[model samples]
Target chain A: MTENRRYRLTAIAVTLPTLMSATAFEAGASEPGLPQLDIATWPSQLFWLVVLFGVGYLVMAKMVTPRIGAVLEKRRQTLDGDLEKARTASSDAAKTRAEYESDLEKARNNAAEFAKQAAMEATKKAEAADAKVARKLADKVASAEAALAKAKTEALANLNDVAAEAAIDAVAALAGIKTTSSQASKTASSIATKLAKQGAN
Target chain B: MSNSEGMHSPVAQFEIKPLVELSLGGYDVSFTNSSLFMLLAIGVSSIFLISAMRRADMVPGRMQGMAEMIYEFVAEMVRSNVGSEGRPYFPFIFTLFVFLLFGNMLGLIPYSYTFTSQIIVTFAMAAFVFVGVTIIALYKHGLHFFSFFVPAGAPKVLIPFLIVIEVISYFVRPVSLSVRLFANMLAGHTMLKVFAGLAVMISGAGGLAMAGSLLPFVALIGLTGLEVLVAALQAYVFTILTCMYLNDALHLH
Candidate 1:
């Protein structure tokens, strides 16, 4: 319906001038010649030309061009702002990442240091325990040596008494003279004492 | 020229009947169909721009898109031809471009008068551009602006001859610019009217001649399309030449 109305309006707009011209022709008007070549129409055409051009130039310069320029400028500013924000955000992320990596590296170094210190402490404790066990073994070796020396002296004394009894029996048998057991024991003891002294020397 | 009896005369279309006869100080400043169409051209351009830019969205709709396209097209022409210093004259160039474009295109409408076909109108515009640019050059460069008519790198003997040629060519700028547009429009419309008249004449004979009329009818259709292109191209030519002239005026070489 709007299309029909628009067409009708256009038809009227186009035909109205033709209809008027036709009526003018019937009213006995002189030939206007070529409208373009008509000298009389030049002044009016020039006049309207100046007027319309002045209006167009003013409107475009004052209103249209400035508005379009402003819109384009606004768009440019918005774009630049968004880009700047993105750049700063990315830089911030990079900074945080660096901080995190450095913190992780420090933590790892701390853990390594702790482990090294623990190993050194454990080695020191083990060395101290080993020294105590070695000292105890040396003390037991010294006591056993002293006990063996005392047992050898007691055995030598018993052998000397047996030798005296044997000597008395032998003298009786060989000499055919019955000597006293006391005398024989004395002699044997004396011999044994001498021998023992020589052995001690 | 007033023979509107059968409405088939090719030349009758150029008649300028007064719509509102007015007189001012013994001058016949009567408003004619030429004035009306010129007014229509202005009105159409204004309405188009106003409506197209009413919303002025960042992402433009169709009308806004067209308006921006025209705006940018003229802006680019000015920038490329006239350079950055030409920025101040952008509005004037843009106005002239749109005005001529609408004037030429609207003339293509059936039963509508084409103001650009008039030599006076085109000459008036060209004279304005010529005078305006010369004034700009004079204001900017003073005495050096006259040096524009002296060709650079000319031998001593050829200097006088070269200057005359340069001066003549410089003065001819307005004439050539106006004639180029006016002639193109006038010829194209006249050819279309002639073919249309042929078709009408042939078909009115009836029977076998009516079938022959189809040939001219087809040619008429083709010419109409060609005329539309010519109209747009002529407008572009006129505008770019104006920019080139402005460039020369500003830069002088």
Candidate 2:
């Protein structure tokens, strides 16, 4: 429908101008050769030009440009928003990655520290056991030596009694008489004391 | 001079003929071919610009892109030439550019009236701009607007001479502005019509002369191409000049 109206308008526009210039130009051939100099038409031209141009300005300012400007504005906003979203997401990713890397690094450091502590503790325990074993061996040897010396001292103390008994037995066998035990012991003691004096002389 | 009938006279394209005879308070305000083409310019521009943005899509189609591009072009022109102060006059400049652009382009159609070719029409528009700019200057700067006619740095001895020249040139703005556009459209279309008539005339001679019509035809084709450039260029020229004038009005010198 609009196209048909346009065609009609174009048809009239093309045809009427021909008919117009046809007569107007023919008349101008006799007078001044330009019909634009025809002062009579100036008012209408100026009038309609203002009217149509005013109409055009209204249509453009009030209608057309605003819509175009709006669309441009909307597109620009949408693009800026999308870029903002992308930037945020990128920064977030970088932050997360850094956190992850730092976490990993901390964990690795902790593991090494634990291992070092464990090794040191184990070494300390081992060294303590070695010292204890050495101490135990030295104590056992000293106690055994004391026990041997004590046994030797005890055996020598018993030797004197045995000598006294032997002396009593010999005296009884040689004299063929059963002297009193006290007399025998006294005799052994006297003999011993005499042996000691001779040795001192 | 091919003074014969049937599109012979180049000035014929410029003639204004009344289509609707309207009387307003005893004045012959008849709507002529000039009015018709003017209406056509408005209609085409309105339809094209409006319909192009009917969807107002975020991503524009072909026509929509063109509409946006035109909008941006005028906006940037206003921004660059007239600065931010001219933002208020953007619609006016945009309208003028679109109007003239469509007028000049539409007239390129064969048998179409070249309304821009008319001195009366171009002068009317120029006169309006001239007067409007003067009013704005006067209003904005008060009586200081007359100082625009004085040369800023001229010697005291030559001040009068320079002021005379400046005032004459200042008053001549409308004429120069109007005549420049009027003569451009008038000459381009006249040349096209004249060459076209020559081709027609030569082709009528038949035989050898008929083949020779190709020369004028080729030239016509080239001229038509050039005229298309001129149409858009002249529209830009008129509009940018308007911006400059408006700039002068809002900002002195």
Best by DockQ: 2
Question: For model 2, what is the C-alpha lDDT against the true structure?
Answer: 0.83
Q: Write the per-residue lDDT of candidate 2 for residues B1-253, one digit (tens) a residue.
A: 2344544566766767889999787667889998999999989999998899898887899999999999899999999988999988888888899999999999999888889998778888899999999999999999998888878888899989998998888888888888789878877887897799889988988898799999999999999999999999999999899899899999886
Q: What residue runs in model 1 are displaced by over 4 Å at the alpha carbon?
A: A1-34, A135-201, B2-7
lDDT for B40 (candidate 2)? 96
lDDT by residue (tens digit), candidate 1, B1-253:
3244344445456656679988877766678788788778778887898788888787888988888888889989999999999999998888888888898899999999888887778999999999999999999899999888887888989989998999899998998898788777766887788798778888988998899999999999999999989998999999999999999989997
Q: How far out, in Å, is residue B156 in model 1?
A: 1.9
lDDT of each: 0.80, 0.83
Q: Candidate 1 chain A — worst ten consecutive residues by lDDT sum?
A: A16-25
Compute the DockQ of candidate 1: 0.25
Candidate 1: Cα lDDT at B215: 98
DockQ, per model, reads 0.25, 0.34
Per-residue lDDT tens digits of candidate 1, residues A1-201? 132444434443533232333333223224322335545566777876787788878877887787766766776788899999999999999999999999999999999999999999999999999999888887888788777777777777666667766777787788876777678778888998898799999
